[model samples]
Target chain A: MKKSFAILATTATLACVLANGTAQAGATLDAVKKKGFIQCGVSDGLPGFSYADDKGKFSGIDVDVCRAAAAALFGDAGKVKYTPLTAKERFTALQSGEIDVLSRNTTWTSTRDSALGLNFTGITYYDGQGFMVNKKLGVKSAKELDGATVCIQAGTTTELNLSDYFRANNMKYTPVTYDKSDESAKSLETGRCDVLTSDQSQLYAQRIKLATPDDFVVLPEVISKEPLGPAVRHGDDEWFDIVKWTLFAMVNTEEMGIDSKNVDEKLKSDNPDVKRLLGVEGDKGKDLGLPNDWVVQIVKQVGNYGEVFERNVGQGSPLKIERGLNALWSQGGLQYAPPVR
Target chain B: MADQQGGVAKPPFWNDPTIRSVAFQIIALCVVVGIGYYLFHNTQTNLQQRGIASGFGFLQNPAGFGIIQHLIPYNESDTYGRVFVVGLLNTLLVSVLGILLATFLGFVIGVARLSRNWLVAKLAMVYIEIFRNIPLLLQIFFWYFAVLRNVPSPRQSLELGDAVFLNIRGFYLPAPVFQPGFWVVPLTLLVGVIATVVVRRWAHRRQEMTGQPFHAFYAGLGLMLGLPLLAFALAGFPLAWDYPVLQGFNFQGGFVIIPELAALLFALSIYTAAFIAEIVRSGIQAVSHGQTEAAYSLGLKPGQTLRLVIIPQAMRVIIPPLTSQYLNLAKNSSLAAAIAYPDLVSIFAGTVLNQTGQAIEVIAMTMAVYLTVSLSISLLMNWYNRRAALMER
Candidate 1:
């Protein structure tokens, strides 16, 4: 009995000591670096955002962000390990160090930032809540959905927003909520819900998957602001800066009209701003603790912000999401990047 | 000579076999404790280094997210502790309903498997084979995705009689809006149960003393029904029923169960019932044929023979496995997450974990809740099983 007590006591003491001292520093970032790869969390399957193709290889706008991070760090985009997570699992995975960054079309919210301890790198997609209903319902406006059954994905801002919208309008609604976006979309497609509410981008993705794509129409109501972005775990200042700046670099490159294809040509430009951005003059990379050609490497490897968006989710793709608020600041949109110098 | 040899051959504590075994056990225990301590210490150290708080003080903070199907009143400002309770209650709600439904369905199918009629027996066999072969998760998805998802819109809802409306959204029925004066109904029912127990005790005592069978069931039923009717009259007929009605596009003034909950419960109950049926069948078969034959030989009718003799014996084998099946059903309720029923796991483990990013605490709390539920169920079932076994003896 005495021996057992001694063992328990020692165990307790050691647990306290290790928990207090040994495990809390830059261990996570160091581990990632040592492994020569960054683990990125992505959506399980959303076309144009993050989805597997016929060969089961992931390719999307979010996937490119992970690749760019890897290229900036290791000079190889393929060094990223993609961990596909559902909406419910994505945040926890980031918080628990299961993944280094979450680029999964996650909305930037105050609660997520402060309460969940996540830092939004920057908004990638400016989205808004929209409703899609079958055309045969003859309801063209969201105002007509007073007593309609709305299918909303649970554990999301969408559910809360949907509730608030209907309550404010003094209209009653029964919400059929699913844990996954696909399930909720499926429910709407199969007529389990009168209307499906989600980001307008998601609505477009879901619409095409319907048996008759022309049967459903997205309503004109933009209910809430959904600024989706890449998020990093809190307390890793260095890693957070690397991710944030990488995204900013892409946006700035696009604004300067220096894309992946013409980046090498633009390196010889006489423009002082373009020259400095291409690492011709200033030592910006040294401050960020990256290679002097980090921006060049990122652009060469992942393309400019506009190119990535077009290839994955915009005009060149099936989703066809217009560059609305996501357009460049010079083009009258919300996206603007700080000067590299 | 044996005593002398035994005394002379006594070993020292270090060389003694029993002493060595104890020593080994102590060493193993120490090693496990050391590793556990190392892990705990490392985690705390890391959290501290990162300036993260270790304790569950975060539970008191406001859960900014809202739940879809809260049985209790909740808002964005509700505390995480309240969310835990809501989740626990939801779990209990599903378990209780699943248990009752599974029991009813299992018993019928179990008896059908051994039916004298060929069609009945064959049908029960088919039901068992088909349901038991599929995974529960797939079944939940199929029902939620392929079946319930196809229900009609509220404007064109399929009406099952005038009392129920089946729509893409949910099942709407006249929600029982309890009147204040309707309290006498439940009170009367409680009185009826007490009256039945009193009459049953009287009947049993009389049977023991005089060796004559008394009609305890009928007399108990009479007292139970009489008291309730009398109470209802004295209370001036306080009870009223709320009839569900359709108004405009959707049904109003009715209780609604969303399609998610419906799909989850439907899939869980049907899938679990198949296994329960097999248990019930084997339980009945475990009782010898002689028990039934002997009961019939004593001039008892088929119903009486089977109920008094066969069932009593069969229950001995049934209770243990039946309890396990109930527990399995309870655990499987976690699959409600797939269909988004806002059950304990979906709301707390999935949503709360995502929002809070406290994987260890969230998972631990979830596991603890389940453990408590499973243990409580087992404790209750064991008590009943003991009583049943004692009666047989």
Candidate 2:
């Protein structure tokens, strides 16, 4: 009787394992395609990058990328589910398949690329660590901040860079660390620290929170290069390629003078690169295992990269960050996408 | 007839009815182990497929970050292991301080709740209810945002004499600076503690033999204080304090308790104290009214009755829940992440997790640290409770 019971339990376990193993692994992609939506991870509440509105509607430059991806796949930019993630939970959420893509102004680093099973498709925002001090402090440059108390957000690259910059310059400073960006900025304003340091964009966002915007001035020192970008999980190569090509296509479309407003008319152009991009000449879509008019759908539905950038973070927006490093490669920027062919 | 010998007839090992139960237990254990192994294997495969490493080697790498509040000296060049230690020490510091403050305030409020003064009782009740009902996270935010942020800057800091200053930057006060021979202080403290222990043993033996009270408290006080002072004097007065000086926009020389630590401590203490107040109130109330009346009837004054009779008996009921409150305070210190206090959770779990991208390792380390702290506190409390109970018996 005991022997039979042992045999039965072993059989049951084996059957369960077999059943799970036999299930199709492409269920995630299938569900995404069927629902015609992409669940994207975004910042919980960082202004100028990703933030929820008064009604809790998520919007930002990061949000635009996810929308663009959905538009490239399903021909509708509105078909995106935004999942708000904190700094700690963002990578895990993507790896766990909780979100299809992460466009949360996350920095691209070697560890994340190799150790977190993440693929950073492209750099969206070029930022750097900077400092903001009260104008009344009479501090013109960060070099003058010897023994100054600095309010820094803990668990960020800024903390590391801040230390490196201070140490390299032979300056002494005390850090008052806080977990959240808002708290650190608040502490600095309240005189808990002499200065607040973070990404240059974040510095601008946080400075406005001061009692008077003119009270604080961001020091003109770019401490460290912060190449922020969008990422997807590593296991799904096909999905990774799709997200990567979608971003590249947008930038390429903009560089080739193709845009949402004129994509339909541009299809008749004689320019070979433009024609191929518009699905007039080659099997670019077939090679990528996508529809023949992938770029067309992306441009028409999500607009070109220039449009997305201008609408979210460029001159048309409050942040108004210059497209210096985010400009096309031909325009003396780092944003170079591979050819479609 | 055979059943009558031992109330039952047991068969041989293989054929016994209980054998099936043993077999079932073994099978269940195997199944659980198998499932656990299978899941682990799947996770390993998944991680391997994505080229992600699963290990703890990252702990020894250069941390590349500087810590704000460290008990031990740390630098950006230090390994991540050192940073972990720094974070662990900070967490322990807050937990210890919070426990001390919470217990003190909790006892006061708890005693106040049982006071005859109507106004005092109602005020204690109001405080307990208000703090106990609201979330600790909300309280942390309220203190960090509404209270601490509203303080004036260092240049115009609200000064308390020349020794202490209250500013939004933090509490700037005199830090006890040790001179070259400062090691003598800790040595003195150790000698004092040893002397106190020796005297206590002697007093206990004397009491056992003579059946008389040996004034153990007075004896302990004299030995501990006298020995420490004598050592300090003999050791050439090894310590001096460096008072905080306001220099332009910042305080220099002396230690400044950062606002993050202050806010975290304040929030944790107040929140934990409320629960402790309830525990204290219930503990005191559980002591019979007859006991209080008997003390009064014995010509004891109100304060004396509380100190000598009521509080000691109340402690018997108060200690167990009070232990839990202390543990809660320690665990809640992890919420220091919300305010960026550089606690173990924030530094190790938040920052290290991001830097290394080893979520499982970082989280496991964090959980293990908290677990060890919580367990040690509870274990120590249990020993104290046992001793207290033994004395009562």
**Number of the top DockQ candidate:** 2
Question: Which one is best on TM-score?
Answer: 1
Q: Where in model 1 is the C-alpha error above 4 Å? A: A1-8, A15-21, A24-29, A136-147, A164-172, A286-289, B1-10, B16-26, B50-54, B64-66, B75-77, B247-249, B390-393
* Residue ranges of candidate 2 with Cα displaced over 4 Å: A1-28, A208-211, B1-15, B180-219, B234-236, B293-309, B390-393
Q: What is the DockQ of each candidate?
A: 0.45, 0.49
lDDT of 1 at B109: 97
lDDT of 2 by residue, A1-341 (tens): 66876776777667657656732234355668887799999876777678788998877778878877787777678899999887767877887778989998777888778888889988888888899988888999988998888888655678788889999999888777665677677677667778899889888877655677788899998988998989987767778888889889988998998988999899889999998998899989878767879899888977888888887778877767788888888998787888898
Clash count for each candidate, listed in order shown:
10, 6
Docking class of 2: acceptable
For every model in order, the fraction of real contacts preserved is: 0.41, 0.51
- The CA-based lDDT of model 1 is what? 0.82
Q: B1-393, model 2: which lDDT tens digit per residue?
A: 876888766677888668778776877776785587567667777777766778899888999877778999898889989889999999999999999999999889988987789999999999999999999999998998888888887777898878888887788878887778767667777887888889889888988899775787887787778777887788898788888897756777677788789999999999999999999989888889899899999998989888888888888898898899998999999998887788888888888887777878888888998899999999999998887663632
Best by lDDT: 2
TM-score for all predictions?
0.91, 0.91
